[model samples]
Target: MRAVVYDTYSQDLSSLEVREVPKPKVGPGTVLVKVKAAGVNPVDWKVMAGYLDPLMDAYFPVIPGWDVAGVVEAVGFDTPEFHVGDEVMAYARKDVVQGGTFAEYVVVPAKAVALKPAELSWEQAGGLPLAGGTAQRALDTLGDLDGKTLLVHGAAGGVGSLAVQLGVARGATVLGTASEKNFDFLRGLGAVPVAYGEGVVERVLEAAGGKVDAVADFVGEQLETTLAVLADGGKHVSIADGGVAEHGGRYVWVRPDGGETARLGELAASGALKVEVAQSFGLDQVAQAFALSQSGHVRGKLVIVP
Candidate 1:
């Protein structure tokens, strides 16, 4: 199997290489998936560059990716949940950095796998797990959004877009922060768009008619505005910034949860959620895909068709 691997941590995307590697063997309670598509996330590059070194362990020569949508080519012993030809998607992050989804195949625990929704394309399914689960986790931390006013920072990006739609689907009045160019995009997701930057608090206040009930910060550095516009006792969460914990808000780190991933798949299948693919790249373009994701300007997912 040909896979992308980086021998050492570095900021340069060129460190990633497509190399011929052994096809991963499945084990008990895990299944081997033939990769169809893999989603490129900022975390992929961040980890590759050693930004997460303190928090996680990394083995040399790591394959870089977590979000995958593929077909089950083989099931491991005692893995009765899926068979050899089932389509599946998973948040396939392991305990340590190695053997990721940016390859011809990945072996994921059966518990981390979900049957991909028939309504979603392979690209959409590949892009769904990580971002969708993150959005769901942040919302879950905020409690019930029904009839509440919710705000999302970075509402145009992958997780943020999903968060905006999920907030609306959960009956929240959603207000989102994005640049003017993406205002229409947010609005299409059923959110009231407020341009981010100077005076964002006032703009968010105006959009929400005052303080919002909860805020989910997808883009970091929104703590000041979040603190200013949150109603008394309002809930808040951030995925990008851990500093939120000091300010009465939680910093969320999404773990692989097949249950939550499947719930998101249901939402997409029911037409209550949409997964946007900003661009798709072939295996050799992994570096370019990583660069685009690192730009922080990608409106949707950057998928690698492997």
Candidate 2:
């Protein structure tokens, strides 16, 4: 199997290599997937560059991919949720040895996997787990969104895009910050688009008619600005580190939730939720994919097709 492998942490994307490696073996309560597509996320690059501390107990030469869409080629014993030949999508446990989905095959815990929606393509399914799950978790943490006004920063990026649609579905008046180019795209997702720049604070307030009920900062830099415009006692959440808490809001680190994944899958299947893939790369182009994600302006998820 050809997999992306990296040993050292560096800013350079070239450190990621597509090389032949032994295929992962399925264990009890696990399933082996023939990976169709793997989503590239900021965490993938961050862990690769040593921005986030890798677990000391885990071995090096890590394969850094959390979101995956693939077909189950084999299933482990005692797994009742799925069987062999199920098309599944998952966010693998961040602490696992085979976190690498940048390959032709990968193994994931059965509990982490969910049936991929029939309505979505492999690329779209690949983009959902991590970003979509994070968005779902953040929204869940903020009580009811019904009739509330919610603001999302970095609204054109992967998680923010999903957050926009999810907020709309929950009956929130969603306002989003994105570059001018993505204004229409954000609007199409049922959000009022505000240009993100020098006066983001004013723009959000203007869009919402006053202050918003809650804010989700997908872009970590605007934590203070978001907090300023939030209604008193309003909930604020962030996937980024420390900033949320520092701003007197909730800090969120996305974790795999099979139940949430199942709910999201149902929404995808029902055409209520949509996953956006901004770009696709072949497995051999893992380095290029990482570079694109690190460039900080990708409009949606970047996917590596194996």
Query: How would you encode candidate 1's per-residue C-alpha lDDT over 156-265 as one tens digit per residue?
Result: 99999999999999999999999999988888899999999999999989878999999999999999999999999899999999999999999999999788889999
TM-scores for all candidates? 0.99, 0.96
Deviation (Å) of 157 in candidate 2: 0.5
The candidate that wins on lDDT is 1
**Whole-model Cα lDDT per candidate?**
0.93, 0.86
For all the candidates, what are their Cα RMSDs to the real structure? 0.8, 1.4
Worst 10 residues of 1 by lDDT: 291-300
What does the lDDT come to for candidate 2?
0.86
The window of 10 residues in a row where model 2 has the poorest summed lDDT is: 51-60
Tens-digit lDDT track of model 2 for 1-306: 888888777777777787788888778888899999989989888777776664533356777788999999988877767877899999975464434788889988887888998899999999999999999999998889999999998899999999999999999999999899999899889999999888888988888999999999888878778877999989998887465786678888767877789889898788778888899999778888888887889998999998
Clashing pairs in 2: none
